[model samples]
Target: MSVLEIKDLHVSVETDQGTKQILRGVDLIINEGEIHAIMGPNGSGKSTLAYTIAGHPKYHVDSGSILLDGAEVLTMTVDERARAGLFLAMQYPVEIPGVTVTNFLRTAKTAIDGEAPAIRTWIKDVRESMVKLRMDKSFAERNVNEGFSGGEKKRNEILQLELLKPKFAVLDETDSGLDVDALKIVSEGVNRAKENTGLGLLLITHYTRILRYIKPDFVHVFVDGRIAEQGGPELADRLEDEGYDRFLTETPVG
Candidate 1:
């Protein structure tokens, strides 16, 4: 079984004031086909963990290791991590000014697979994924995320997830900026990808709305840059009702 393990991870970033720590010894394991939801308040380091796993240059790992199938992910470059079947769906996807969506997706798929996809099959897959995400065919010709709405950008992210078929995906606040219909559409896309690939997921979010569509096998409460509590889906329901107030009260922010 494929496994992604985070062991005593400590990450820091340079700010205007100076170096400030974000993750403080976060340890977790995600097995293949498992969905792990990380619910936390703002500044709780959920996004930091996602970026660090994807090997973002901005977040420096002071100590600890991220292992993918026993391979050290911390040492791998960003693209290397993707090639190794690790994917990150950014909260705020950036715009690629000149690259068309078709070209960008194909390029990324080629990079990860180490070969150009067969044009016939690749075109079919992309079109099908777009249709599944409720995206129109015209999006294929548009520049990547350029002039796209928030919902459109999110669907684009999921489109990549479905096409790339990574072993694991860290969705950093993917539910943000989505309306009810858009949320359901995006969540369905994520679920479809997981079903097709058996990809493990680390879903990070503050609200529990997304959890209704994409059920999590395990729910973790992140507070003060660490997992304060964890449980089954019932925990998410509890948090929905009680909110993060209890966690915020118990755990002081760093």
Candidate 2:
């Protein structure tokens, strides 16, 4: 089975004031087909972990390793990491002004697969995935995320997720800005991707609402740049009832 491992990962970023540390000694292993939920308060290093795994240049890895199937992911470039079957669905997806959704998706697919996909097959796959995500056919001709609503942008992210079929995906606050209907649709799309590809997931969120739709096999509570507690799905239920007050009161461990 494919596995993604994070070992003693310590990360920092440069701010105007000085270098600010984010993730500290975060160690977790996600085997294929497992859904891991990361819940934490603001500034708890949840997004930092996501961006760090995706090799965002701003986040510096001071020490430790992120390994994918035993390969060092920290050593790979951003595109190289994507080609290696690592995917990150950003909390705020950026707009690609000049690139049509069609061209962008095809180009990304070609890069990841090392060859252009057969035209008819590629078109059909894109259409089907888009339909599943409730995206309109006209969206194919529009520039990526340009003039799109928040829900549209998120659907576009899951569109890439389904079509790209990565080994693992880090969805950083995907439910943000989504309404009840949009949330359900996006969650279903995510579930379909997991079922189709058996991709492992690192789902990060502040609220547990998304967890109701996309159940996690493991729930990890992030506090002070590291995991404060971890448990099964029951933990998420408990979190919903009782806030992060319990975790926040405890002193952080190095």
Candidate 3:
């Protein structure tokens, strides 16, 4: 079953200097219980694609359609998209100064699932997920992402993934700025979530290190705001061996 679909997606940002086109005629499809990796350089619009799919207000879809489970997601609001089982683990997680992680998780769970879990049951589940991510219990009491190291924030995102159990997840550079140990823990959490919930994943990243831990069913090379090439895991290996120079030279920007 196709869990998520993007057809000819074109996104642009309104700025002081007119609208800047980011994603240009991009198309992607992710099936249920599969892992799809979007690999590209820094400014290739990988994150833009993630945000556009997640219904980020800043990114206006000038043209195209996003469908989740056959529903038109481009017409939905951000929270509506999230409630429809689409989760985006942002590359740079925002810090909520006064909100504890526990409070944030509970509110989000209530909003997404339509009811909060029982207090004791929810805490227990959160603690277990933290343990699986090798996170300390104190993290639940702290403000969300405030004063947390890069790895800690990433792990916290995984914690939410476990708690929410979304049908589809877009991990935008979740492995960025992490050390080896932290990377393994985050990847393990993702693996466990997929195993336990059968969540489809669209992992966007520049480095191939994370792919070493979490094998992808399909790997796509994004260049010039569109998919330059796509193949099985071997595509990732080829990109690892030979840099993105070929993609850059061949794929023209629209």
The candidate that wins on lDDT is: 2
Q: Write the per-residue lDDT of candidate 3 for residues 50-119, one digit (tens) a residue.
A: 8888877899889998888889999898999999999999999999999999999999999998987899
lDDT of 1 by residue, 1-254 (tens): 99999999899999999999999989899999999999988998999999999988999999999999999998898899999999999999999999999999999999999999999999999999999999999999999999999999999999999999999999999999999999999999999999899999999999999999999999999998899999999999999999888887786332
Candidate 2 wrong stretches, greater than 4 Å: none
The number of clashing residue pairs in each candidate reads: 0, 0, 0
Pairs that collide in candidate 2 are none
Residue 82 in candidate 2, Cα distance off native in Å: 0.3
TM-score, cand. 1: 0.97
The lDDT of each candidate is: 0.95, 0.95, 0.92
What does candidate 2's lDDT look like per residue over 13-49, in tens digits?
A: 9999999998889999999999999998899999999
User: Which scores higher on TM-score, 1 or 2?
Assistant: 2
Q: Which ten contiguous residues of candidate 2 have the minimum total lDDT?
A: 245-254
The estimated TM-scores of all candidates read 0.97, 0.98, 0.97
Best model number under TM-score: 2
Q: Please list the residue runs of candidate 3 whose C-alpha ends up more than 4 Å from where it truly belongs after superposition.
A: 252-254
